[model samples]
Target chain A: MSLIGLISFIGTIIIFLLSKKVYKKMNWIILSPLLICPLIIIAILLITHTSYSDYNSGATWLSKLLGPATVAFAVPIYKNFPLLKKHAKAIGLSLVTGSAVAIISSFLFAMWIGLSNDMVNSLVPRSITTPIAMDISEIIGGEPTMTAVFVIVTGLTGSIIGPLVIKYIRIRTSAAKGLLLGMGAHGCGTSKAFEIGELEGTYSSLAMIVAALISIVLSDTFFPVLQHYLVG
Target chain B: MYMKIIKIILQIIFLYGILLLGDGIARLVHLPIPGSIIGLVLLFTALQLHIVKLEWVDLGAGLLTGELLLFFVPSAVGVVQYDQILGVIGVKLVAVIVLSTIVVMACTGLVADSVQKRGAKKA
Candidate 1:
């Protein structure tokens, strides 16, 4: 990477760190680093006429670190294992059915709209966290970049409308409400759950991780059958 | 301070080693899931069996998780490449996402709520 690219990468991280502070301080979802950092980086790239390739040169280093970071998720999953075991049946059943509903509906809708195969696969995993969604998208021949956009949009939308929907549904427990948010909105929703209560945050975090695992398993099995059905 | 730095670096190497082992096994076995995920499972196992202590790698993993979102920023910023492609399917993508999200959220909440409530009654 060139000197400018290195500077750009460091500068982007610094700016994103600042935006995250603002996000936490203001408590506005709009200021989410997930939303703002990308916008800021893209804007800088555009204004400076730094091509995507040049920017990617330095950015790829950060991306490479994503692998270890994803692996690190095991720590939290392990920490929560006891809670996970306690509610195993409910969480398991909820994840399977929720992911099924998401996959089948989104696939049918995508097919109905005549979306290409890649878009269908990508859209199918939009509800998962960004890293896992991106991985799933790539494995299924979808665009990771598009997957991120889809994830962000889906998560942001769910976070925005989730409370109203939950209120109308009258879910009696914070755990239940958190499950809804986590499965539907992922990282974005889990953060929102943190605002609601401790139990909500715990369930949301658990749901988020469990839902990702369930989605991966589902896609592994469902993708082959769906592929044959959709394109055959 | 010096020992702390070394410990952090060693833990990072441990995590990275697991990732590579996962990649190797995935290739040999033709696993559909990604290598890092497999590494995650292996690491968890190691911790459970006392093959690897949590303290050894927890700090290293914390370093990764702390700025985990930052790692994704570069790739997410790759959205610029999809400007034209998005213009084509943007509306449909948005619609599908919106509809599915609502349905998933409602159902998951209802299911978890009712299931737990029933379990409580039974116990």
Candidate 2:
């Protein structure tokens, strides 16, 4: 790689590590590495007059690792299969409903605000985890990078308001709470679930996996039809 | 220590192999879904069927997922390019995402909670 590429790559890792430290010390969701690390990297690139292509030459290497990491998701899903089976009905029905609502509501909201089809497609996958969400965005003719931004912003929003929703709604069941966070926010929500309890965390993660799978299946089927009618 | 490192590397390679297998299958079948997702399902099924043991991939998988966010940085940072698109409607877009998040949380939590409560009562 070129020296510029190397700088971008190394700079990302260093900033990520430091940002993780800051998040730990502050425990503030706003300071999350997912939110700030990119902000810092983008600022550096702009200030240095470095084009994204130059930075990406090296950073793309890290992004490629996401493919294998996506496969790696199976380990946790497999480990938690028993739990998934145990609460099959509740998880199944709710995730089906939740995933449907996620897509439908995103489309409605995006359309209500007069966003184009592309932005709606991107926003539809905003509720899922990043890698899968990005994949879905590409599949449906949305900009994956824009979807990534929407996904992170969605994560931050959901995690921030998730606790307040739980409190005001008087949700007492850990399973319900976990499903709410995971289905609503994905990874950040799962982390928030952990802070509440282990069971909440476990269920939250399970919700993310199942919700993602369901959303994928929906993307191939329901999503296109929705787009045809709504955006067409 | 050396063995541990070797094991991790080998497991990662194994995972990569599975990812490639997924890509091959997706191409062959012309599936609409992404191959990594196909690989995820395949791996999960293999574990369930005892065709692939969990220990073989556990450490490497853990390592990858643990740093998953790092993998997303390049793509997310690419958002900088879309500044012009986001500049005008950014505020409205953020509001939509926030409002939708609240709606999603409410619907999911309420539905799940009621279903769970009914299940508990029936038991």
Candidate 3:
């Protein structure tokens, strides 16, 4: 690899690790490693006038790891199977409903604001985890990079507001609390769920995985029909 | 310690093999879904059937999933390429996501809670 590649590669890891420590110490939403690390990297690339391709030359390998990570999702989903089995009724209904609501509402809002068809497609899967969302984006002809941004923003916003919504609504059950965070924000929501309680965290992670599956099915079967009606 | 490291490496390789198989199936069949997702389903099914033990893949899968954020950081930063889109409608786009997130959170929580309450009442 070129010196630039090595620098970008090592720099990304160092920044990410440092930001993780800062986030741990600060425990602030704005300081989240996901949001902060990327922001800092982007700023550095911009200020130094380095092109994205140069940075990505080394970073693409890291990005490709997402494929294996996607398969790895099965582990958590499998481990959490018992939780799904326990709250089978509540989880099944709520997540299906939540996933539907997430996709439909995102489409409607995007259309109402007059986003392009491709942009609408990207927004539809923004509520799911990044890997699956990007995959769904590509399958549906959306821009995967744009979809990633939307997913991250959704996660950040969802985690920030998820707890407040739970508190205000007086959502009592750990199952409901978990599903809300997981379905609403994906990974970030699951972490926040952990802060609230252990059971909430388990349920949240289960909800996140199940919600991704639900959204995938919905995107394949339901979203196209909705798009035809609204955009056509 | 060396044995543990080797075990994880081997398990990861096994998982990667499933991923390859899934990609092959998707290409052969021309499935609309992505291969990784298909791999996820395939792995989940294997684990459920006890064909692939959870203990076998658990540690390796856990490591990959735990670092999921790092894997995507490059792609997320690729957004810098879309400065034109972000310049024009970034605020509106953020608005849409924030609004939709709030709606989904409230709706999911309320619906799930109410359903659980009804079930509790009946029982």
Candidate 4:
């Protein structure tokens, strides 16, 4: 392997090792690998002035694994089928309402602040996963790359702070909590849901999948109408 | 152990095939969403219909799901490449993210609570 590849490998190993110790001291709730990794990269970039391309070249192999990882979510959904069936109506309703509100609220907020159309488009799919968010960004004339960043930021913040929000509000059911986190926050929230319990994780994963689908369809149909009536 | 590895490899190939097929259909029909999302929806539908057994796909999917955050590293790394653009739009980006997150969380929480209460009433 090349030097950069070796460095990336070693870096990941180090993070994995540190994670164990960190996990012991902090609740998995507070210290997420998701939140830590980017900060590590940023710190490295700032200190070493290492080019992003060099780091990405080393990291791309791991990144490509995302496709298979996303596919892997199917396992939990399958395992949780019984619970899902029991709560089918509640899950379905939450997904629809949560997704609609997420899209509309984000769009309105973007408009309220008078962001450019491209910037607004980037903001449109902020709650969805990267792949879906990128597609929505392109269709709406936003920069896909920026949308990806916004998606990660949105996910990370949601995942990290989501539980606190839930606790403060005193929302109790596993299904309700998971669906809200998953729909509003995507992968990040799903991870947090997983940390809470298997049941929460399962619902959160299902919610993430459903929310992404709902957001894509809503954006396609509603964005144009929004543009005509609100933007124009 | 060897059998498990082989199974995972097969599952990956199967999922990729589904993604490609979905992409092709989307391209042909000019669908707004990407082929992969369509593939995911198709897969979910197939699972619900019992057309495809979940047993074979479960292990691979489970492994992948736990490590989902790692998948975003590439794109996140890509952000570092656009330091100038980010610097220019940084405030707007932060505003959009922070504001949207609060809105999404609040709205989802309200909707979920109402749905749960409705479900409880029926039960």
Q: How well is candidate 2 docked (DockQ)?
A: 0.62
For model 4 the interface RMSD, in Å, equals: 2.4
lDDT of 4 by residue, A45-114 (tens): 6788777767766777777666555655666777678879888878777788777777677788877877
Worst 10 residues of 2 chain A by lDDT: A190-199
lDDT of 2 by residue, B16-95 (tens): 99999999999899875668878888998999999999889998987776766777778768867766447768887888
Candidate 3 lDDT over A5-88, as tens digits, reads 889888998898898899889988767777788899999998999999999988887777667767877776677778668678
Pairs that clash in candidate 3: none
Candidate 4 RMSD to the real structure: 3.0
Ranking by DockQ: 2, 3, 1, 4
lDDT of each: 0.79, 0.84, 0.83, 0.75
Residue-wise C-alpha lDDT for candidate 3, range B20-52, written one tens digit per residue: 988999889987566777888999899999998
Top DockQ hit: 2
Name every residue pair that clashes in candidate 4.
A72-B61
Off by over 4 Å in 2: A129-149, A159-170, A187-202, A216-232
The RMSD of every model to the true structure, in order and in angstroms, is 3.4, 3.0, 2.9, 3.0
Tell me how each candidate scores on DockQ against the true complex.
0.57, 0.62, 0.61, 0.49
Question: Model 2, A1-232: lDDT tens per residue?
Answer: 9988898888899998898899889988677677788999989888988899999999998888878877887886677778767788888888898999999998899899998878788888999988788889998889887888888778767877899899999998888999999999986787678668767876787788788989989998999999888767
Candidate 2: residue pairs that collide: none
